[model samples]
Target: MMTFSPQLEQKFAKMLTAYPEGKKRSAVVPMLIYAQDEVGSITPELIDEVARRCEVTPLQVDEVVGYYSMLHRKPMGKFHVQVCTNISCLLVGGMELYEHACKKLGISHKQVTADGQISLEEVECMGACSWAPAVEINYDFHHHVTPEKLDQLIDGLRKAQ
Candidate 1:
């Protein structure tokens, strides 16, 4: 059985209104974000509910989820730290910073902290090559991140939680 909290259903309804009468499918991305905002992750149950609400197939919703990097099929920590490991970032100490962060947390990239507060991942790019060695925690960007900066960023996120 699939269902959404009333608030989520309301959000979906409102988002659908923004599109043409038969174009509710156009709201898939934003609806997914709404679900993600409410549930913390884009679980399979949420996908089915989104599909049902949008009058689309579950496979269509799954495809949308897979195409978007921001969407997650599994649960993540409270703070998801995605470090850019692309060419520019790598040239600017991205690897070292990632390694240092992993060592500090005693977990590698794509692993969550034991406390379930932080999940670290190595990403290709964040479109901020000029700000090489950047990281995004919960989609908030931190540029020119060194090991010290990463530590400071983690500290701030931890405190906020």
Candidate 2:
């Protein structure tokens, strides 16, 4: 069985406490997210551990994982790049930006680089319409990105690794 670090255990406890009585199940999603943030991907052990803590069935935790887009069953790259191509972004050259990133990274959507340093995904929306043509590397959002800027961003991330 995989053990969660003390810090993660404390976070889980804090999250569980934030909910009212009999609502522990509500913490499932966030708990899984936090767990993934630490361990990468939703492992069987994590599903079981979360299920035990939330007092829900392992199957229930699995269901929750499958429902959320942010949750992943497999490990992603160290830097996961998500480009928004929704209408708001599309109107501002988001699709072109995505193409530029794909070409630059030499990887298609949902594909990781051969070195496992980066992964790319074309998302529908990132809720950054006003900043249109937004890109997210991991949790940080970059607004109004151009092809040259994307190159710089990717190059920077590569160098950081």
Candidate 3:
């Protein structure tokens, strides 16, 4: 049987309680997030476990995962770096920033570092058009970033790991 940490179990319980009867499926997103935070990615076993807890089918859970950019099936590093390269950001050197990050980390998009400290991805709009060239390291958002700033951020994450 799949097991989550005690804290995650509590969080899942609390999340499920927030939904009314027959609406437990609404808890799928947060549950998957917590599970992924613990496991690094959305595994098939996690899909089935989340489905069973939410009273939904594994296919239903899989569909939810597919719909969200934040969800992933493959393993990622401890820090997942997402660079936005949407039109809004691209106009302001987002692609350049992404390339800089790739060169700095020596890894291409959707690839993890050898030590598994960081993973990089070029993503779509993060709804921060006003702050173009924004990047997300895990859950934290950094806006109006330059290559130098990204270097500091990534280096910090590496050290944190």
lDDT values of the candidates? Answer: 0.84, 0.91, 0.92
lDDT for model 3, please.
0.92
| Sort by TM-score, top down from the best | 2, 3, 1
How big is the positional error of residue 143 in model 1, measured in Å on the Cα after superposition?
1.2
Question: Which residue segments of model 1 deviate by more than 4 Å?
Answer: 1-11
The TM-score of candidate 2 is 0.95
lDDT per residue (tens digit) for residues 1-161 in model 2: 46688998888878999999999999999899988988888999999998989999999999888888888898888999999999999999999999998999999988899998899999978799999889999999999899999999999998899
Query: In candidate 1, which residue pairs clash?
Result: none
The estimated TM-scores of all candidates read: 0.86, 0.95, 0.91
lDDT by residue (tens digit), candidate 3, 60-122: 999999998778899988898999999999999999999999999999989999998899999
User: Pick by TM-score: which candidate is best?
Assistant: 2
By lDDT, is 1 or 3 better?
3
lDDT of 1 at 30: 92
Quote the lDDT for 83 in model 3: 95
Tell me the TM-score of model 3: 0.91
lDDT tens per residue, model 1, 1-161: 56568987787768889998899899888989878967888888888888887889999999889898778877778889888888999998988988888887778867788888888888887898998888888868888888988988888888898
Model 3 steric clash pairs: none
